[model samples]
Target: MNNPNALASQSFDLAAQQHPHLLRSASYNYPHRCAFKAVDDGDTQTVNQRLSISPLAIWLNLPARRFDTALGRDFLDSLIAEITLRKEAFGRRPVTQLLLRHPFLHYQGADITELMHLLASNFRLNHRDNSPIEYCAELLLEEAEGANLALLKGLGFNEFLLSLPASPSRGDYEKLHAIWQHAREFAADSLGVRLPYGYPEQDLHSMRALLDQILSLKPDRILLTPASELDRWNLQDHIHEHGSNSASQFALIYNALRHAGYRVLGNDCFVIGRDSLAIAQNQNRLRRTAIAYNSVNAADLLGLGPAASSQLGSRYESNLEAIQPYIENLQLHKLAIDKVLQLGTKAKACRVVADQLLCYHRLDIHYIENRYELALASLAENISWEFNAEANMELMRIHNGLLQLSDDGIMRLLFISDTFLAGLLKTPKKD
Candidate 1:
């Protein structure tokens, strides 16, 4: 791909095939490969060597689908086993974040509390801390009762990202408003609202109303996500049509939020401009993820639970997706990994540069060239970037060996980042 415009005009499926690693997401991280493997003592030794590179930040992700079935004793035992493995693998490495996604939808209230305490104890995380773990709960708004929020806060979750239904009812609005007030009273650090757009049923007016209600609460952040549920059945004609018009919707929301003195941070997140994430963005410390921000730069992520992904050094892997196999593996005291992708030296360099661009919207060109031993200047000279201010308002520029993105460039970060990604992924000519 030459530029953002070129990427926009190409066949998405074809581009994805060509650069699956680069095009994983326009804004999120996803593993590019999944290769099944058996877990045993040999695997354990491999894991131990990789994990010895410690002080990696921990992100415990509990995906909701596994809990859809009634919370059984076996599942609890699986949870204990996984936690034990995590603790033993990376001993005393503090968990910086916990993501409990929509657990309230399936489990009973008491069960939720029990699970929280279990995690808290094993993970060495509690409700109160001078250096608190970012415990974010992504719950359906309908399930975000005052009681639920209170329980979460009591269990060490400082952040809340509530998901709104495509077309929420008046009662839903009222409940969300009440929950916002409860969040304030309970001293929650951040309360974010997320709405999944790109469905035919949702109109701009209703979206506006939802944004208005969310803004009235003075939320810390607002996110707009694309709803791709229809894609499963190959009924994406409406989704595609609406997805195009959704750009206008985004322009409307972006303008409205900016007018209201809010900062449009990153692609889809709008912040009120004073919270930790917003501050992190200003200080260039913000690292955006699917659910939240990482304040620190360069921390490895270790994910636990069913289908969780991990990024440790040059290694990227995931737990078994099937709960039965995952639980069974842990029951047998083995690693529940389903796939592993060990990055090549070139791929690692590309990933690091891509991460810097995504995280900070600029690349320290000198730092990268020296560290990776790459001829970036000659490589950059051969590649054409969108640098004309007249055509695209100076989308990207390289001056004095510093590669930077303009505001418009940052808006098209995925494509811009992919340009360098493609270059780095190319096989080097042998001497």
Candidate 2:
């Protein structure tokens, strides 16, 4: 196979030349491979001796069908033993110091320790880090929540909310109030003392009262959760019965909050009319607030669990799924990898592009060009795509709201969907 580093080098070169400003200190070069020297027969093999070599190197040199065969599993197990002994040493080297030198290597090593153990055991890595035994469990939990939010933003819900914030114009509120009163009188007589199941007469009265209260509060933001039985029914069904009453309610509430100068945040999924509430900010205030929903997209995600998975670039591998196998393998100084998959480069590129688009919305054409050059130089270019100037225009049109072309003719990200953002990794996804 062609060298991955060479390809990466070529891409990096292109990106560096075009967007030197963006990649001030980014490494465009890949690490070089070195030959291993045989140890003297007279010398004893100690933990320090094992730490001298790269665990990745040991795993790569294994001949078990390259992560698919029994031999590969054994190789992985051995690698884990070496890593466990060296973990403390590894941690002793402050990450802050490393970041000062190589700011782009953002992941923490502790996150991948458990996966190292699991890989030594010849089991499939689950890639889920929710277990108590998992190292860096807290970090993984935060990553999971961020991932979920990214998914939500990707579904275009953010854009929907952006539009809904303007629905409650003062004129519209007055109209809604009149309509509500009229509906209340009609319902009072039509039911003749029996109210609707979900929409009882009292509920309408309550809704009206709530509206009044909201007007009085004049909050800068209002969050509402429909605690009534109407919430259980479909939105379409509610709209049919209420003749845009729900829509008006949303609009009125939103506009009321806006007039009151509060920012509103909520969704159709909200219950109890309001659960968690907060003040809203204007565009200028929001830009300064630095309030971002959880989102992360990184090239790899390494998880550590009895059975954890490590997603390297596009490839995914899992270790033994149970604690017993993992611990036993670790005791034996073995790797637990039980499953491995190689993904297509297109898929990998798509993930990368999706993440980039979601975060910044604009593709840096010059950056892509330089990256292509660097990939070529490094011989790590595993994927092929037409990333010329024209491609940038096409991508912009596809993800309209998320990206914008800068004055320099490079793509600049505009508004990334929370879904895509969540997928981006702020830390290493492993452990």
Candidate 3:
């Protein structure tokens, strides 16, 4: 059998060469011109000026353009197939049925007409059924409308358009609004109940109310997504500069949720309360925190629209941002996975340590040593002689401080005011 390791090394080099710009862009200190521009633009808009523009108003007038292209679609398909093969080979267990059923996992990009055609062809090829595909297409449409509404609200245009006078612009706003409203209504009627809005509200009271509702559901896991709220608010401001009332409401809501004991899990994802804390703390205490939950645990995260990411195990895949490339790729039966990273044990270990330290402000060295079979003394030995002595001697350092060694010979990182968990997690930059 062909060795995957040999293939991976070759693929890695090929990927690096093919996407030199992206590879180079991975450096942490890369300067961002757009950020500087945004900062510069922030001061120019007055509150009155902000009031005139709805965050989503510009997009309302802008064409409802498709973002993915044929090339991108084909690339994504091929990529998905490749990644799926790799996942089956190396992943710990069979991809769960729950994962396959998840909304995020089952997501295919929004161009319903295109997706329908593709589904129809697949049905024809298999000669099995078309009902599932038909149902999925309808579901996809509903999801698209929901996303559009989210974008509208997030961009601050939802309120702005609502506040607009009856005019051509208002008519345009109504057209887009009607499309999504109808979609939601259709879904409700078909599903036989009101679909729960997964998104949090924009007011503290409303947000708290939403949390109470979520808590009542007694979910096994909760994802905290402060960044999504922030992004929506920020994007709204960017759309017109002054920011919208809806975005302001969103920010207020997000803050309230955070105050109510939601801890961030990953980017734009959070889990609620003591349960999440307990899980994280236990993982930290056990030192298997890193291996337990991570990108690998992300069952199926399907990209719903353009420029979105989907995660299956440790493999993260993305779709093309442009409409043309996405279409062309799909026409060619390809999946647009522009980048792929098959994380190794070392990388996974680093991620775990980083996440624990960052979230809990502590580390269980005993847990790490026991789980990974690496000794703290050995780790200390690897440090330079001077730093090594400091680490070794610090075993008897002051009590109740930020850094401490437990009775079991595990290192405990307390609330060290000056230090951040990121420093410990990061790997040294490769020259």
Which candidate leads the pack in TM-score?
1
Model 2, 196-304: lDDT tens per residue? 1223222334555555633542222222433132134553354346533433454444444444443222121111122112211112111100011111111233333
Q: RMSD to native for every prediction? A: 4.9, 20.9, 17.7
What C-alpha lDDT does candidate 1 achieve relative to the native structure?
0.63
**lDDT accuracy of residue 301 in candidate 1:** 72
What lDDT score is found at residue 273 in candidate 1?
Answer: 72
TM-score of each: 0.81, 0.27, 0.36
List runs of model 3 lying over 4 Å from the truth.
1-93, 97-222, 227-316, 342-346, 355-362, 366-421, 425-431
lDDT tens digits by residue: candidate 3, 68-102:
44234454354344334323222332221111111
User: In model 2, where do residues sit more than 4 Å from their true spots?
Assistant: 1-302, 311-315, 341-348, 365-431
Error of 1 at 257 (Å): 3.4
Pick the winner on lDDT between candidates 1 and 2: 1
Question: Per-residue lDDT for 1-431 in model 1, tens only?
Answer: 13434433232333344433221124552212221232333355446634563334455555544343675767667866787776655655556666677767666778777776666666555346576456788888667878888887777778888888778889888888887777789887778887666567777898788778877887787876655531232323543456455555655666677678776554556777787767877887676443345664425676777777777655676788777898899889877988776766677667667667766667777776787776565445333343343234677677888777765665555545565666554524321
